[model samples]
Target: MRTTLDFTPLFRSSIGFDRMLNALEAASRVETIDNWPQYDIAKFGEDDYRITMAVAGFSQNELTITQEQNMLMVSGQKAGEDEGQYLHRGIAERVFRRRFELADHVKVVGASLVDGLLTIDLKRELPEEMKPRRIEIATGEKLPRAGTKQIETGKQAA
Candidate 1:
């Protein structure tokens, strides 16, 4: 069976959700993504992420990493040489652009170029107010949680 989630109540309770919905709708419209210099995204912890891109042939001076709004963009372009006679040019020295989406509270730690790959590390430091807390349960008291239902099918409520 398929069930639909009703976000109407949440939308009504929130103060500024229309802009968020519009932003999400705009993000959904993004169908084409620039893929260059094969990359890998690895999760380190509950909020840590690392993005490593296989950036061969490009030097440290050519690679550029920037953050705008909520997106992390990386681009590279090699400088052309004027004193090169190419009789059999096979290597590609083209420019490439890559983008990575960042989650809320995530910040770019920095980037490093080692060997032939460029690695960019990101970390999400959740505030104390946002992180889950371990609450001690009382002997006969019940706790209420958000996004969850407490169903008493056969057990009696104390």
Candidate 2:
């Protein structure tokens, strides 16, 4: 049985997290029956990741990868039906589309298809300003004080 999740309460209590909540809601709506052309996501390093999809009968021209904003979409469609009838069809050849939500600063570096496996590589390249930085603290004596220690009359009589 499939269960639904309501995000109304979270919507009211959260700020700037609409996209995350929306992704959760979208995931819940995915149908289990539509799972085909299985894929795997693996992380090799802190900022390096890969996605491998099984596409036995699909050619490079039949598949397309697109990236828009923070979303990565991979889709494939059969060019033509098989000419001869198969005694027992074991491979999946239907059209399929898969979407992956990417985090900020994450980028798709390369993709390759080998031995029926479609491998896509990703890397996280944070911009200079967005990367972690250290703040220098001023010591008590090192910090230059503003104004004089005590105030005195503007001028003295001749």
Task: Tell me, by TM-score, which candidate is best.
Answer: 2
Clashes of 1: 0
**Which runs in model 2 stand beyond 4 Å of their true positions?**
1-3, 140-158
Across residues 1-158, which tens digit of lDDT does each residue of candidate 2 receive?
88899999999999999989998998899566666779999999899999999999999999999999899999999999979989999888989999889988889999999999999999999999988999988677666678766657888879
> What TM-score do all the candidates reach, one by one?
0.63, 0.78
Top of the candidates by lDDT: 2
lDDT, model 1, position 87: 92
Q: Note the Cα lDDT for every prediction shown.
A: 0.80, 0.92
In model 1, which residue pairs have backbone atoms overlapping below 3 Å? none
Task: Supply candidate 1's per-residue lDDT for 139.
Answer: 86
Task: List where candidate 1 sits over 4 angstroms from the true fold.
Answer: 1-34, 133-158
